[model samples]
Target: MSGVVEGLEGRVFTVLGAAGFVGQRVVSRLRAAGAEVFAPARGDPALWTRPLGHVVYAAGLTADYLVRPFDTVEAHVGLLARVLKEAQWESLVYLSSTRLYDSLGAVDAHEALPLRLDPGQPRHLYDLSKALGESLCHTQGQGRARVARLACVYEGAQDADGFLPSLLRQVMAAGAQPGAPRPAIEVPSSPSFERDYVHVSDVVEGLVHLALRGQHTIYNLASGENTSNASLFDGLGRRWACELRATLPAGPSEAPRIRIDRMREEFGWRPKGLHSVLDAMKETCP
Candidate 1:
């Protein structure tokens, strides 16, 4: 178990979307810290009726957001609006994504930078909805809400969606057979496609820190570094003795390096880098 967060013992916490990858981890961490956790199911009427002591709104769609646009909006904005309007909470931490910076094309992604979005683009649906959710939290939260712009979060070879996790899953599956020939892994994305990957546990810690002790309304929960797909595949190939291949041609990584000075200065937090975590996973992989 990870180190428990101080001052969390006996406190009440209500984690929305408790069944999700991130939400599940948040609930586990809170419980391990001796906190009271209420993980309500979707459409649970108690969400609006009961006094939600401290709320972590980890409910949001990813991976399938493009196909499930309506469901994405509801998860990102609809239910959130209801909670802010009706649910009573001492504090609320809304989980937003650093992917919001993808369209900016800037070198450094800071929390205060102005964002631009083209509504006509289909991909903007996810960004637009999440931005609106952040707006709602800021406008209606009555000063009790904080936003965490999380970067790409991964957990080794966990059977979840997302670039890094999916790639790791593929590698693990190919290497499952004992004494099998080295696996030839073909990556779906371009070699230069990159993201600011942060571990799921770090994200949970950052969310809890924001909900409990964050002084700023907005904070970026990221590793403050960008990892390219090429580098990732290279590390995997070396560690697993697998052949690496990329389906797409090499391209420039457009995503900017996310800034984490606020998180570091405020909470004294620093997350493990992608290769460090990957190396650790290699040791434990069967």
Candidate 2:
């Protein structure tokens, strides 16, 4: 993404979660476009030389571990803070999450949504950390950093857990069921419940967009379309005849529709709809 880097060609663009789904794609996109992508988790500090182009901090551990808690949010916040202070980068594109807001759970929400952090309540540490990290970046970077608030990023099939692998397995499975279970996602989620699913590529584009120009602006990088899990399953099952099932109901009454208006207005980035998302998954599925 030299276009994304503009004048940062040959400069080190440190990607933290290099082995992750999104990180891998970002690395590929950058390397393919002739950018020097450095994966920090794979090695030592020597690899991370000076003149860092854009520290795309996407590394994160889920808040699944609650008993013996590790402060991942503070760690990432400190990491970015250190990177910004020491690394030789013009700006940063920290990949924050839409999970920071409950409004982001059911439908579209702008950046104006409330992010009330309750120390008493148990929550996904990742989300809490994301909010903290974003706050740090904004406070520190001021006008030199950009926060790309991403929605759910996926491209491949899903698994038993409604992830990409599960979806893919259902689609490519032998003698796939296509009518009743033609893909039934049983979520307590209302047919009215919606989520803004963002394709990995589109998220990358928004990051690339901000990486090249916008700074310190929090842009919601999403498809801006509220897609119900049932609708998504039905559409794909109709075409692929694969079964997608969800046994549990969805929580969070709010329609967490993520808005991408800022991304569109700022970087001229518009994500492809869910229909195309399924089509791409079908092709990518084995």
Candidate 3:
């Protein structure tokens, strides 16, 4: 433990959703830090998850993610139940969403803010399922679980789950070349709606820190900054050295802004800002 980070040297960790964007990053970080990470293949827990040192449950699905919600919810719930029942590790980090937080118009929210979305809200089937899964983990892992309730994480490559891709499509559409009509860029999001957007790297840092600390704490893992789509497009334009503009639509959907005080206090995780994201997009764009 002298050279390697403490509490992780030679440890066996299990990561659900290892193929996912976030799960893959978490697994890589764990492997780099000298932890043997196990990933349950296709929701099968019995295949490769026996001596678990830590568990990072990052598996999720949605309309944008895949085909449907109900098709994936059972597998997730079953996998979670199995993990809780067989958590040989001292600690577990469940990846819950900030969507459960109230859609507080423009209010800043914290971990203490009660999740206002009814456990049975039917608007988004995915949100409802996530709430149920979180409830299960919270109940079973009362004192042993470290629930890392995360916000939007932008790698800036091609994740359509958030506002980035849609906004990018709009801007690109705005530049639709000669002869080709430039589709309208919706004005409502010209100033991107403010959401707790965190970079995936910082998210990994927070998750890794929580996994090893054994604090049994639930923390809000966010960017700790207020950001809008307008700022994002401006940054992208600078990165590409081209004018990026969009039409501001009326009354964009706004989610609660989560405060990341607990993340900073616990793991010292400060997310990369909009400029960093733009730079990432620049490098990633072909």
Which number leads on TM-score?
A: 1
Clash count, one per candidate: 0, 26, 8
Which scores higher on TM-score, 1 or 2? 1
Lowest lDDT sum, 10 consecutive residues, model 2, at 183-192
**CA lDDT of every candidate:** 0.87, 0.67, 0.68
After TM-score superposition, what is the CA distance of residue 35 in candidate 2 from its true location, in Å?
Answer: 1.4
As for candidate 1, its clashing pairs are none
Between candidates 2 and 3, the lDDT winner: 3
Per-residue accuracy of model 3 over 52-97 as CA lDDT, tens digit each: 7677888777444246556567645766776688656667787877
User: Candidate 1 — what's its lDDT?
Assistant: 0.87
Superposed Cα RMSD, model 2: 3.9
Predicted structure with the largest lDDT when compared to the true one:
1
By lDDT, the better pick of 1 and 3 is 1
Candidate 1 runs further than 4 Å off: 1-4, 175-181
TM-score between model 2 and native: 0.81
* Ranking of all candidate structures by their TM-score, best first: 1, 2, 3
Between prediction 1 and prediction 2, the one with superior lDDT is: 1
